[model samples]
Target: MTVFSVNHVTTYAYAEPVRLGEHRMMLRPRDSNDQRLLEASLAIDPPPKTLRWIHDVFDNCVAVATFSGETRELRVENRITLEHTPFEGDEFLLDDSARFYPFAYDAEETPDLARSIERHSPDPSGELDRWVRHFLHPGRPTETGELLMTLNYAIKEGFYYERRVEKGTQSALETLARRRGSCRDFATLMMEAARALGFAARFVSGYLYVPDCDGENRHLGGGSTHAWLQIYLPGSGWVEFDPTNGIVGNRDLIRVAVAREARQAIPLYGSYFADNATASTMDVEVRVRQSPSCELPSAPHRNL
Candidate 1:
């Protein structure tokens, strides 16, 4: 079991001060088998007059608060200590998942996922077609660890991660054409690619305690969240892979929830416009610490 100190902070600033109104929040994590939640607390500047907690389709904690004016400042922070216990390692892949995920026998109406399979047909675009080709080729790797290592190298070898918010439902071909994507886009593309090749891949959203991230960092879930992809293999179970960063594993992944797509995994997301005008601003920060700075666990294998 690994112990970690995780903290997250998010604040928003408006272009101009206007009459503030009621605000809704979906900023808390829900229960899941992947990660255990120890404790959580939320603070809002110019505190809200009323707060009503609601659960979304994915069962995430959503809060609605009444505010008086525009330029409202909101902050959410969570402290959690959890362990991986039985991590899904290289051995798990060869025994169970390798056989189960590669066939389309188990696609169901999973309401929790935002991106649905509108239609299932052969992808003509070489984009996913190529990845599928690789996934299906003989000599498939023996474990999830090898899959992560191989994918990390492939993404880094193909393109670079620049700053930008990916828009719309891009076909696997479209993402392949661009060779660039946001956290959600990258993870989505990976999920599609995995599914195309017959793998049970899910989306995950939560905090990643990175030392280099300062003040406020851009969100993978974007706007108000962070996201990544998870693949289930036997014995190993579900393991996370951050195609954006190229290096996050059982040792680092602070999982909040696992669902079908980025939308379901978002921390705070809803649609509401008071008047004819639409307006919104978001801020986010993340911090990670280790007590005593004792001997570190084994470092993850480097990407090729």
Candidate 2:
């Protein structure tokens, strides 16, 4: 088991005071068997007049803040400490019936996984279908797990990683054509490809913890938020795949929120109104560090 302390800070600067709209924040990690949240705290500057917590469609904790006055700057800071038990690989062995390619889910499990199995983007040109077809073999049955691992590694090795400051992700075809994209773009491509192959997949937004192994820094997508995908198998359930790093499990993935699409899992969302010529800028910083033997005073269960 490993413990970590994560700090995330976001600041918005405006040329003049502006009216801030309701802001939604998704900064807390969801509790699961493999991970436990010990303590969490959030501080917002130009404090909102009202703040409330709500669970979204995907059951992610979302903070809704409404402000009555205007401010020249807005800042949001979040801190969390948690314990993560590394899930071993052998623990996810598939059932005998699902060990090979082209397996079916039980008749009872189809409806709930329907939305995730369908592609969210337009594939009118059949580009995505053709891309996934490259992994198929006609006569020989492929090991399902091996095929997925190959596809994951192929993305990391075949494409270039580009850090984008844009607000949204690119389409799957757009990323495939350029062979370069941000973490979210790569994850969307992989998720859509898996869905085209009749697998249920979803987008995951979280933090990547890069440890100092051998006193060298060799990991990507660690200094900020990261994106990946999760595919559901019959016996193994939902398994994480980080195509950006060719990682196949939850070893370094500290999940904060999950959704059927990337936009639904944004860490922060809001709008402000200002004069047509008024300008604004945003800055975000995220840091994740190992807290060897540190512990918090209390375990809080409050939301937002």
Candidate 3:
């Protein structure tokens, strides 16, 4: 078992004082069978007038903060400690029916997963479909797990990792054309590609932990929030894949929220009302490290 502490700070600096509106944040890590949240706290400068927590359609915890006064700078800090049990890609066993490509999902589960399987981006040219087909050889059997892993690694090796501070994810076609993009862009591409292959794929937004020992092998998209995708497989359920780092399973990926599309999983967003007081700059800092002490009990704990 590994315990980790994550500190995330986001600040928005304006040209002058402005009336801040309600801000929604998704900084808390999700508690699952393999991962447990130990403790969490959030601090905001010029304290919010009211703060409330609610679960969205996807059952992700979201914090909504409303402010009354005005300030030139808006800052939000989140700290959390979690216990994670790593799972490797090879550990999962797929059902016999889904062990190979060109499989079908259970009839009952198809309804719920249909939206995820449907491609969100338009692929009129069938470019993305042709790209995904490369993993499957004609007139021969293809191992499902191997195909997915190869695709994940292909993105990491084939494309350049570009850090884009701008909002929104690029369409899969855009990433394919450039052969380079941010972590989210890579995730979006993988998600769309998997969907085209008749798989239920979702976008995951969270923090990634990189140990000091990694040194030269440190993962990319670490100093800030990271993005990845999960594909649902029979027997194994939803399996994670980080194309940006060629990571499989949960490993060092700490998930905060999951969405059918990237736009639905913004970490922090809000607007400020001001006249002629345009925003000047925005900065984000994230740090994820292994904790020195483990406080979780040996017995398995249920998610709260």
TM-score of 2: 0.94
* Residue-level lDDT for 103 in candidate 3: 97
Model 2, poorest ten-residue lDDT window? 295-304
- Candidate 2, position 183, lDDT: 92
The 10 consecutive residues of candidate 3 with the worst lDDT sum are: 295-304
Error of 1 at 275 (Å): 7.3
C-alpha lDDT of candidate 2 relative to the true structure: 0.87
Q: Estimate TM-scores for all models.
A: 0.70, 0.94, 0.94
lDDT of 3 by residue, 1-304 (tens): 7888899999999998899988999988788999999999999998999999999999999999999977999889999999988863325678899988989999999999999999999999899999999999799998898889899989999999999999889999999999999999999999999999999999999998765562454578988999999999998899889999988877788999999999999999998998884856889999988877423222221110
Estimate the lDDT of model 1: 0.55
Give the alpha carbon lDDT tens digit for every residue of 103-180 in model 1: 232333233222433223247645575764564336654344455456655664575555453334444466667887
| Cα shift from native, residue 242, model 2 (Å) | 0.5
The model with the greatest TM-score is 3
Q: After aligning candidate 2 to the native by TM-score, how far in Å is the CA of 42 from where it should be?
A: 0.5
Which regions of candidate 3 fall more than 4 Å away from where they truly are?
A: 88-90, 293-304
lDDT tens per residue, model 2, 193-282: 999889999999999887664566556787788999999988888988899988887876899999999999999989998766668898
lDDT of 1 at 19: 47
Rank by lDDT, descending?
Answer: 3, 2, 1
